[model samples]
Target: MRRLAPLILWALACSAAAAADVSGRVSTAADGVNVVPLAEGSVIEVVLTTSGGEQVRTFAARDGAFALAGVPAGRHVVSAYNSRFVFPEVHVDVTASGVQAAALVFNGAPIPASPLVIRPAGVAQYYEARKAVDVVGFIKTPYGLMIAFSVFAMVVMPMMKVDPEEYREAMSSLRGGDGGGAVEQSGGGGRSGGGGARSGGGMQPTGAGAQRRQIRDR
Candidate 1:
């Protein structure tokens, strides 16, 4: 029974972190510090070594981000290196599932340390839960082949409708505010369309003279 103590504790820990996701990105430099994403859809080697020398699991996934589930909390050293000679190595520490750290920004050699993980596990869960880019199918017919590139673009491109310019404009407008009362500033210049709309929203009496109708009649 004594030998089973550690095993039992391990089992419990795994169960606790089963729903926990642990992942992060390794950049070549700071945010937009001028480094390409390691590789597009290329799996890099990730080796995790713990202080206790546990046989940690490693996975080969796309370069932008990586994840490992069921991580029993402690000081964990995660080393990620791409197979191809492109981006530099990215090292990160998973102090636990609750510590907020910096995003692993990779640049030249001598990679600097960043507190990329406030809650390491939470960050990983967020990236993993995010839906990946979806690519659509293309036809092989002559006409289809002629525009196959366009079809490929349509599929590969992210379905984002919000234009950056429009979003910035809206943000700027909100910051400036609505300039107080918009309706009051209308100066009764135009026909009382605003009043008419409000009146329409309320119950307009069928045989009314000029008196406003009550809302309950609706």
Candidate 2:
């Protein structure tokens, strides 16, 4: 149960397809450490949002593997967050084509929720991304796996948008990169993920969610 979210997110994130191959090695934006590939029993998460504020997506990381699938082609906000480690928000764009080699970095400091205005979505992206990279960067040492897998991903939200247990469970298995989870439709027209985890299209995107609020006033 606890590990499900990351495992699912990783499987889904790696599953994203595009007009071209939507695949590349992951690394840290700051230092550029190549993130290890996803493995079994590893949990990771990411966040994604659109510029138009239309779609938002979340992903899971398992065994150091993760993915963001079923996203609309355009420039969008891709943030990195985690409940355990500290990182900053990075804005990236996907083309009508797709996303290629992107690195989500851990800023190594606590990022307050006030900035994003959305807690879990932003925080989770960092945690997941940090964890994913750390897992792969492990260099076997006399001590053990040379690298420390656990970075400092702290959860700071008080009244979370989702349940505490879920948030924690999601957080533990969570980390965010622009917050995009592959969407699996209940029924099928062009539905993907078939009984599998899908992208985060259904969830109101942070940018779009904010936009809707503005529209109502106008």
Candidate 3:
């Protein structure tokens, strides 16, 4: 047991020397100095990624402060995550001495004076709200007007009543005003004791001889 005790102590010391603690504050400012007011129930997740593909995650406090203990000494990257906001990846160097804050980058460009501060670049919008329909405004458009006219023709016009005599008179007046034709009647001489009638200008007999013949036949 005594021989194993020395080996256990040496192993513990080496492990302690290899790991370090990384501490920083995640703020809404680029300089990591000014702290912004966060929304209620807002939670920011701080992640520490080592060069060896190891990751350690923790939540930031209400004041945006975070700490990851027992992180292996090496070059590492610190980043913040949230659904509502976008965060830039921060490069941090962790050694046996302490955690050294480095440049924070966004889109390959270094942000000046922004060390550990993780401000959101912009708000993320996953969905768009539907717009409410405006009946009056729609009716003012050309398509809407066309639809309204179609509805009026299909629904309202059929429900209306018209007198046959009035419709015939209106049609006759329209035709006469346009010089469409004239109605002519022969003297009463047909077998039915009624005058023979012809309609339309071109359909009637033109010459005097044809007129006399038509009259005699009638």
lDDT of each: 0.50, 0.43, 0.73
Relative to the true structure, candidate 2 reaches a TM of 0.29
- Candidate ranking under lDDT, highest first, comes to 3, 1, 2
Worst 10 residues of 2 by lDDT: 113-122
Cα lDDT tens digits for candidate 2, 1-218: 88899999886665454222122212222233333343344333456666667645454433223455566555555554444433345444455365532332344333221122212222123333343445333555533342233321223333334677777667755665324333323345355553244445544476698999999999
What is the per-residue lDDT of model 3 for residues 1-218, given as tens digits with 9 covering 90 to 100? 99999999999999899898777776665444554566678899999898999899999998777888889877778888876667778777677766664666445444322235556665657889888999999999999999999999999897686778888888988768534332222222442342324334445546667989889999
lDDT of 1 by residue, 152-213 (tens): 67875644566899888798788764554555567574558777887786755544633435
CA lDDT of 177 in candidate 2?
30
Candidate 1: list runs displaced more than 4 Å.
1-20, 28-32, 37-42, 59-63, 85-218
Candidate 3 overall lDDT versus native: 0.73
Off by over 4 Å in 2: 1-43, 100-218
How displaced is residue 144 in candidate 2, in Å? 50
For TM-score, the strongest prediction is 3
